[model samples]
Target: MADFDYDLFVIGGGSGGVRAARTAAATGARVALAEESRMGGTCVIRGCVPKKLMVFASDYADLAEDAKAYGWDAEIGTFDWPRFRGKLHAELDRLEKVYRSMLEKSDVEVFDSRARLADAHSVELADGVRKTAKHILIATGGHPFRPDMPCADLGLVSNDLFLMEELPKNVLIIGGGYIACEFACILNGLGVDVTLYHRGGQILRGFDEEARGLVAEMIADSGVSIHTGTNIVEMKLADEVDVETGTISNSDAALGAPAKNDSTSLGENPKSETRQKAGKRIWVKSTTGREGTFDHVIFATGRRPSTADMGLEDVGVELGRSGEIVVDEYSQSTVPSIYAIGDVTSRLELTPVAIREGMAFVETVFKGNRTPVDHELVPSAVFTRPELGTIGLTEEEASERGEIEVYCTSFRPMRQAFIDKPARTLLKLIVDRETRVILGCHIVADEAGEMIQLVGIAVKAGMTKEQFDRTCAVHPTISEEIVTMREPVRAG
Candidate 1:
């Protein structure tokens, strides 16, 4: 037998990595993990934690407006962006420390450097230090991606949005995904003029059409200027240029056009490139020839796997066409000895999925029990203005595969009816027509994220429409719509 330094060596101390390492160590297997950044990875540092705080911070605007109904005198209202940023950072730092402490308590050695594949069973740290292990795991997750425009350098990605010292008075965010909508809601609620642009006809593309429409309406009501089916073809940055007469003036056309040596026109008109200089803000011509600008631009477009620098090719591990690692139901990579889980593998990009996969992997490999993750009933949430929560299949998907009955209810919540908030909530239930089993539950409302979790459990337990109807409704609660809506509007 070959001597190994550790039983398992994990790269990336994110949720999947930490969970696997801690669980494996608890089973009496020696483990060591390496992280190039902070301990809690994206969820703790940038993605979930900070994003929720922003969501809460943005809610105060509406809450303040509603304070009068709660019998408080309408008073002055103010928001200090820098103060919120400071408090958010402090909390994040504390959480990072707690995660580190937890891993140490589990007896997992944590290395604070990038881990690169030296070989199938060996990992090299950033400083050329190398270590060998019997098995390896990669859970590096992913990073935000921005569109490639002429002045892409001047734009900000999702990760960078949290660190801004000052908020923009008017911001232009590009993308239709949840990240873009969430940030648009956050900024618009906090009094920033937000304009959202996307290439799709509708936002939240994969979600149910009605739920997506409701969220789009709620976001629009929250004061965001939304633009769908659009993208920036060119960005004309505002910069000073000296004219031939030796006078310096702010010129939009002064900056050279995007390089054309690469055969891409960059969607710019050569004849009118310098002829259409505008004011302080540069005009960005769209694919449809529309032009506008704002003080700041953010691209919540999408994210790609962060496996670029980790040296996967060196280890001969294969990745999917989408650049995610390929893994089986047991989270085992093509290389039998190594395994992967979480966003890197793209099974489902939720923390719970990753956690379950981590536990399952450890069970089969170390604890002598084989377990597999069932991805069919996974639940997800989108923290937009009204919030969105969903589990299982959409009505269209359920209908396409087999006959199904869809129950849907739409109404203005009591609070909104009183305040005239110009918004409403949507609830939907999809069930198999023949079997009568609940197939999906979708909610779009204020606390939809919290509300759908219970519904998810019901569906996961194989609840039927009759079972849902037999349950008593909690009077005056928004969630009661789930069980009370006995009839669905027919869709031919």
Candidate 2:
């Protein structure tokens, strides 16, 4: 028998890789892992953790006003971005330590370097060190992408948002996905003016139409200027825009459109030193031919798996068009010894899903138990101003499968009603007419993310509409409406 240095060599230190590494080690198999960046990958480092912290900070923006309505003397002071950023970094540093500790405790060997495939069984590191293993798992995760337009570097991706030294006074966000909408809400809550542009006719395209629509509505109500069917055609530095922009068309105006001048361009002060330090004042022209200058332009356009520069193809691993590693139900690549999970596989990009895939991979490979990944009925949450939680097939999806009845409700919850806020809560369930099974559940409200977890359990269990109606309602709460929604708002 040919001997290997380790039984399992896991690549990527993100949640998925870490889980697999530790679990495999616990099984008394020799395991090793490599990570070039922070140990926690995107979720702990950039993607979810810090983003959700910003969500928490942003949520407090309305509290002072709401406090006044609740008979409290309160006024929110100016946000201290530097201090918050410092603490955020400190927290991230602590979490990285925890992740490192988990591997160490599991007795998994760790290397602080990037790893790629040298062959079916050998893993190569950035420093040209090669480690041979019986099996290899790739979970390098993914990264946000910026468009390939001229002067596109002037725009920032979602990853850049966390590293900002100072938040911009105003920002123009491109793309209509959850990341774009989430950041729009975050910036608006942080007292920054936000404008959003998406070429799509609507945001959150894959989600249930009504639920995503409500999320967009609440985000826009929070003062995010959303322009669907729009995209940036041209981008230039303010200095260049000032010198070269001779003819500015107001696409909306037919004739006598006003040309932009220096004083009315972007900011009142337009400090050159500040502009240089804050990157550059960017002037953007929309596809519709309208123009505007912003302190920052963010492209939350898309994400690509981190498959570039890796020698996967040479070793016979199939990759999808998006550069995601192609794997089967058991998470095995075409090269049997090489497996992948997480965002790298592009199956389901959520952190928890990645972790689950890692466990399934372990069970299939190490335990003599072959387990195919179950990609069904996974619940997802978008942490906007009011969160969006969804599970199972959407009304549109369920209807296509067969006849579906959509029972949905939209109303100002008691808390918002008491404060007289325009915010409203939405609860929806899509049920099959014949099976009487609840095919989907969608929620748009505060704590919707938390609410959907238990709701997801029921949906995943294939509970019928009658089963839901059998449950008792928790009164005086936003979620009670979920159990109490009896009649179909619409049917097909």
Candidate 3:
């Protein structure tokens, strides 16, 4: 396939790639897009789409319990793992087909193989086929990483977790990030014994502090054993010959601490690091000398841009110190004709952000419009037990720049109070004291993500606190707290 005739070639037919390719092609530019795996990338296939579905499914478990209080005699429920998995797979399959059809209808040349840089303006396919274009775009996304522990290979990564043959009985998730938090909710909701271990005081560390505290409280109350400030030092697979190995898998106790070593019992038998190749038990030692075993282990650590094996360096595309491609305001790479968008550029990892960036890139170059991506006030959500959503600055952050008035509210959610669930929803607003502008708005509660979407629009439009106050309150709604807050809880 030595066809070298195109104006723009996008690598990786994920969200950004498809958006850019379709947009560019619509503007009378010859476009080619190559994707090795399923279209729609991580979000549609494995990450956001399936994960959010799981989150919605998980929330039902609590809702079922809460239903009894609402005068419905809901039976103690059992989750059908196979049914849920089948439904998720079917939905993903439909989406994949839709993405394919959309690209085909747009007249964008689609390659069903991985695209690697053959030269600055040319890319070679996995089968040694080559194609050339005036511009090359890299939209390859990221993958989850599992560290090298004794039995690290035995556990599953993010993509692997989605494709599990069957649901786990007891799952031990190793990570403190948002991914870890979301997975804990999934497994626990599915009736799996889930123990989450993170080497930090809180999960979702970068989010607002109050949001972190509220999620921690809600998740623990929902039956998840949230272990913070703990690290998994070593992992040993289950069903090993050594009898003492089983004790090393306990969750509450630290595994790797020097004091916990039973020197007398082992008789110097080479420290028993053996693991069963097929079965699920993993012996892990943490920084706190905690040892635990679980039926399955999931590594929800983090991700890096999927730029490897694609030959970015060969194409002379400049990458940041973090290995992300350097893209300008218009998402153009250092190479004048080449451009990059989405996670590969490390600008914003959200699916919507990638779509917007891809559209902006197409608008600037193809449509002859000078459009620049502004990433300042995009809002995001985390789907943990008590969901988290925030946009704009934190109270401390806004105050650090200048004197600000902080309005804070914490109260038991009306529904939870009646159900005897001891969970509280938190809301805080940082308003500039001089301008009365709402500098930031943050919320940590049920439907926090859903609530923050509207708040994000207000923040992006630079809405002031006075405007928020002037807006009529929607009575009996939690979100109306933003408009109804009477006084600053703290002023500095």
Return the top candidate by lDDT: 2
lDDT of 1 at 371: 88
* lDDT (tens digit, per residue) of candidate 2 on 1-492: 779999999999999999999988988999999998889998998889999999999999889999999999999899998899999989989999999999999999999998889999998999999999999999999887667666565566777677677878889999999999889999899999999999999998999999999898888888999999999888766644453665433332112122211101111222323554845577788999978888888888888898887899999999999899999899999998999999998989999999999999889888989989999999999999799999999888988988889999999988889988899989999999999998999999999999999899999999999999999998888898888988898998
What are the RMSDs of all candidates, in order?
5.8, 6.4, 6.8
Please report how far candidate 1 places residue 306 from its true position, in Å. Answer: 1.1
lDDT of 2: 0.86
Error of 2 at 174 (Å): 0.6
TM-score winner: 2
Residue by residue across 53-172, what tens digits does model 3's lDDT show?
888877677675788888898876677767888898899899999999999999998999877888888889999988888888888877665575544555566666555556767878
Tens-digit lDDT string for candidate 1 (105-216) = 9999999998888888899999999999998988888777545545564556677667766776788888998889999998887889998889999999888888898899
Q: Model 2: runs farther than 4 Å from truth?
A: 240-279
Q: For model 2, what is the alpha-carbon lDDT of residue 423?
A: 93
Q: What does candidate 1 score in Cα RMSD to the true structure?
A: 5.8
